[model samples]
Target: MEWYDKKTYIEVYPPKEFSFYECIAFLSRSSQEVLHQIKDGSIYKLLKIEDSLVLCRIRYEENAIKVDFPDRQPEKEGCSLVAKFIWEWFDLEADLKEFYQLASNDGILKGIAKSYSGLRIMCIPDLFEALVWAVLGQQINLTFAYTLKKRFVERFGESLMFAGETYWVFPTYEKIASLQVDDLRELQFTVRKAEYIIGIAEEMVSGNLSKEKLLQKRDFNEVKKSLVSIRGIGDWTANYVMMKCLHDTSSLPIADVGLHNALKNILGLERKPSIEEIKEYAANWSGWEAYATFYLWRSLYDEAI
Candidate 1:
């Protein structure tokens, strides 16, 4: 991998309340350059995939914002978009004052924010792609999911070379939508995953799954219900995709195995919580269930460390 250095300055349209360091940490979790080592409270490890190591940090001073990615210099046109990406990922502009007030009134929100800082529920704004990835990851180890995604991206995604290295874009629905199930299976996807991806693609291409329309609804539960109505998407997959990709703050994957295990361990329960138990436990989270899940996941890894 090749490495480049760049500095970016962004104007914060609305003043943000979260710590700059926390924002960087949250953004880094979503960056392809950093692999979040959850075994230890979500410490980021720079993976030397090809040859480059990317590290990012942020500095906030009154009206000006400074973002530094030491190892990779961003292309000129991408700078503004990158800044927006970080801001959106951290939800830096969200009105946190209201949430804080609510947290003071509710013990669960206070405990959750104090413990994990609302670091989860960062959505990538690409619902179709996120849904496909979530379905591919179901009931399987994350390593395998990454491997499959890598292959899929390399095969179907467009590539751009910057600073003497190559980066691939996530495959577009139009591209993957054209692929046959056999083509996906050749890339090591299971029959179920292939079918699910194809189904999602068909829906997207046929205009049944409209990202614009989904965002317009603004009701998390309604979007989730719509997603699960698709043939291959279940509860876990729907909630996970909505939380991560749609940035649905209210969505929670109560049936997720990792979440269940993490909650059991953190709350000192004897065994993993059942889906019903998890739902009841998370009820207090209300509008912040996705953040609650993030805290539980952090606690899970932190406990191991």
Candidate 2:
């Protein structure tokens, strides 16, 4: 058992009602996330800000969350950047109480809120990483997707050793965009996937796409259109990026297997809901569709729900 680094405590005050442990549970959904270290109910992650790789440990403490980096003391600007990234990544400012109020009338969402009250959407906070992860998960089981992610990160990402363990940061666009398709071949990337990954990275490196630009869009539809215009991005991928990366609560990928399975299990249906059926049933969700989907996805792990 790993524990928090008490010698280097830094405090982060959340703007809205927050639950540190609940957020960790959401981030822990995938073991393939190499960038984070979760130990003894606290979460640690290596954040790459400019040229510095800052290692942070986060846990609940009083009204504000506590963060500590054992290796060094970060500058004020670096600490601010870390706080901003964490705020967005955990959606600390989102008004989930309003979402809960909305869910109160819906069947599935009501149960979801009751089961996981303070859970927030965990975001990658990096557009390139989110896009690549969405592509890697296409047409495959999550287990295999995680395997691919672990391999890809270890192959190209930067890392540092802390307390005898290595912490990794995702590869930068500059490094990945310069690579040829042949570079990822040994990782078992389908030729098409390799091309797609490289193509997206190239666009990012060229300033054609970015999280800032995407966030500038007016609505979910506009964001979806912009994302789908990029090669290798389709409806499902676009919706996923919008929901997870952009924090668009209205974005919902109706075709997600987890959504289907979760609905089937919750509603006691013998088969998964059709896209048409989901649309009809989810019509009442309106602006809360993403939360609805998230809660259903959580049902996969939380049996008590």
Candidate 3:
């Protein structure tokens, strides 16, 4: 994870292409975000590690991401897990040189790559969170999606009180596996979304699906097929999960409205571009489709409200 425990806090050194500011900006895009809180250029999040709650204050310091414990620091083992989580969350292992090279030649991405050079594909790290979040966002505006998420988390997720503030972690699959559709519907989640999330949680509880098993498939199509094999998970959901959870660089969610809007802004079009045209413009993105799309999403900071 490229980090070490400095006794007081853990220091994580990310790749040169990573910008803590850019990532924190993305995280802070939603004022309704309950998972993390951004304050004074640092992000505060409550994480569950080895069944314990760890409150972390993450900020950039001397070219490295410093994780300090505002509540309490766990043992060395917990520190390592937090470091690994940070690595995956920021996608530090990814080499963006090739993606930048590809973006330079594409008209749609050329300026974006340069404008947001150090931005990485901030990931969900947890497969269940990624899947359920994608489901919650389906066919909803970004602001409303975040509202649903906040309501869902505040209702079912665990929280820790630290210095007069409550920090939360995403509700575990085990917690949601026992829930019924009506339980989630009370939080304003659609019937289909509630079913989809509960079903996914049940699958996890039954040991039928997992991030490990999905990645074991290796091939992109195989992974997509496995995800789509689950009811309510379609092509867009599969691609979104692959990119955010599995770290699949080639995963492209072409139907994303934010991507279309970014293209409209960059290409100076009066209307949204056709799906076929998006495919053609994105042809060069090939292996870097996920990165390209993420960069485009960043172009519209209000994409998530």
Candidate 4:
């Protein structure tokens, strides 16, 4: 097992009340009994309380991340900054007004927004990790992708134990880079996924890809272009990462199977639309494409239920 630590401080606006468990529920990647896992003391565990910041440790199967707190309690003055980090990491506090407006303009999107109000964009600071995950998820069901990820993480990640539970941190680029394609395949990843993951790691290690620089770019298209320059990263994978990890509001994944199916069902089309058809349909969404995509995904989820 291995241990890693980081300090996170949240500023509450108007001195809003906070429930630590609520925050954990909002931040978890998986929805299947995630809240129950936290309550059962298997996933996230509170470590210490300090002033306005509450310190905690997040436990996975074999890894742990330590979260430290600030010296003072939250207040209105620091709320936006605190909210930004919290939402970026776990909470969804972006310009909901804009999202609502976009949703209201479309019937399908409106229903999605109403049905899944808690859904929010996620941001991962590690570009390599995001890219690799996207690669692993391609052309496969999310359940299978998650299973592969859980196994890969447990096998390769560093872990730590606090109280009685364990926490895991995603494996570093260096750790994954050292592995061969066969090693990843043994962990349940397809050969294509293994190659893509390693290709991304090698490029990052060799200084061919710089996530920081990409984030600094003002134009989202430029960032997407740069990301796709790496081998095995196509339009869908690149746009997905840009929206989820880079927080680009304009990034829309039109090629996703879920998105296609959702649009087909919502529009009452005779068949699933092609990628070109989805792009043409999304022309009206423009600046709010990410929200549109989110709503489409939600629509699909609602249909499944």
Question: Relative to the true structure, how large is the alpha-carbon lDDT of every model?
Answer: 0.64, 0.84, 0.90, 0.64
TM-score of 2: 0.94
Residue lDDT tens for model 2, 169-213: 888888999999999888998988899999999999999899888
Candidate 2 achieves a global lDDT of: 0.84
Candidate 3 lDDT: 0.90
Q: What is the lDDT of residue 294 in candidate 1?
A: 65
Estimate, for each residue in 1-305, the C-alpha lDDT of model 3 and write its tens digit: 32334348899998778778778877877789999999888888899999999999898999999998877898999999999999999998889989988888888899889988888998999999999999988999988999999988999899999868999899999999999999999999888899999999999999889998898885989999989999889999999999998999999998998889999988999999999999998888889999999999999985435
Candidate with more favorable, higher lDDT: 1 or 3: 3
Count of clashes in candidate 4: 11
Worst 10 residues of 2 by lDDT: 1-10
Off by over 4 Å in 3: 1-7, 302-305
Off by over 4 Å in 4: 1-85, 90-93
Top-scoring candidate (lDDT): 3
What TM-score fits each model?
0.75, 0.94, 0.95, 0.75
- Best-to-worst ranking by lDDT: 3, 2, 1, 4
How well does candidate 4 match the true structure in TM-score terms? 0.75
lDDT of 4 by residue, 1-305 (tens): 32443334333331122224433444443553211135343234222122233223333222222232222233444444334444455324456567767777776677766655545554554577678778878988877887887787778865545456555556678788889999998987878889888888888888778777887777887898888888899999999888877778788887788888888898899999987887787787777788688657655654555
